[model samples]
Target: MSASKKARAAARLSAVQALYQFDMEGTLMATLLDEFHRHRLGMEIDEEKFEKADVAFFDDIVKGAVARREEIDAVLSQKLASGWSLERLDKTMLQILRAGAYELMARADVPTGAVITEYVDVAHAFFEEREAKFVNGVLDAVAKSVR
Candidate 1:
């Protein structure tokens, strides 16, 4: 991927991580996102470069996903393997599903395939190959439902 695209993808991954933190721990989303930026600055990464990144869509993405979490989880509970409930899902996989489904449902400008592929790729950052496949499958189901 191009650097700009990579940065955007990174932002999405960051957003997903923030969402996971909020969902799993009841953290305030605003505090989490701010903490994310603060920690990134502490890490000495280019704050301006990251801030200038195409992440304006992130808040919408995160908020939409959270707002419809119950609905999204219902979709997931229905579409995943028979034994796989949303609560039983791997954290990264659940985050991937949430991120991709959020874009699929709310961001009509983004190609469904792009959202799915990007999130599946993001899943690779923390999951095994098999986990990416699971993400792919769940997101494919989500894409079909949204379409």
Candidate 2:
């Protein structure tokens, strides 16, 4: 991958992780962003080095997703099938959806296909192929509506 491509992929991964942290820990957005900036981005953990992320893009995604969460969730809820709701989704899946939804709705510069593909890649990092497919389907539905 080119440097920008790698940075964006890393940003997507980090944004999902940040969103997961926000949901699970109830950490404030500002605090979480600061923590990631100060400690996590491009840092090594357990002897594994993280990719150098696009800090500005990472900030935009996390902030945008959090700022517009209710709207994003409503759109996501609609895309879900009967008897399934956002609350029923796994936490990681939920974050992935939210991040993808935020991008589809707000990041006009990014192609819709790119958003879906990136989040599916993010899902693959934490989940089985089935979950990645689920992310792909939900994100495709979300992109259709928002893009």
Candidate 3:
């Protein structure tokens, strides 16, 4: 991957984690952004070195997802299986969808394919292939509607 591509991938990964923390812990937006910028992005944790992320992209995804959560969630909720509500989703899975949905709805500069693929990769980090494919399916649906 090119440097920008790698950085953006890292940003998407970090943005999902940040959004997950926000969802589960109710961390305030400023606090969430601060924590990620200060301690997580590109920071070594447990001796595992994180790649340098695109800070602006990271901020946009994390901030945008949270800022427009209701809109994003509405789009996501519609794309879910008929009986599966957002609340029924695993929290991490929800964050993946929210971030990906936000990107599709707002980041027109990012191709729909790339948005879906990146979040599918992010989903892979925390889930099995089934969940990753679920992410792909949901994000693809959302992209189709929005983009």
How would you order the candidates by lDDT, starting with the best?
2, 3, 1
lDDT of every model, 2 decimals: 0.77, 0.94, 0.93
- The backbone clash count of each candidate, in order, is 0, 0, 0
Model 3 Cα shift for residue 73 (angstroms): 0.8
Best by lDDT: 2
**Tens-digit lDDT track for model 3 on 18-129?**
9888988999999989999999999999999999999999999998998899999889999999889999999999999999999999999999999999999998899999
RMSD of 3: 0.7
**Model 2: per-residue lDDT, tens digit, 1-147?**
899999999999999999999989999988999999999999998999999999999999999999999999999999998999998889989999999999999999999988999999999899999999999999999989987
Give candidate 2 misplaced runs (Cα > 4 Å): none
Q: Give candidates' CA RMSD values in order.
A: 3.1, 0.7, 0.7
Better of 1 and 2 by TM-score: 2
Off by over 4 Å in 1: 41-53
Tens digits of per-residue lDDT for model 1 on 75-136?
87888887778888777678778878888877888888888888888888888898888888
Lowest lDDT block of 10, candidate 3: 16-25
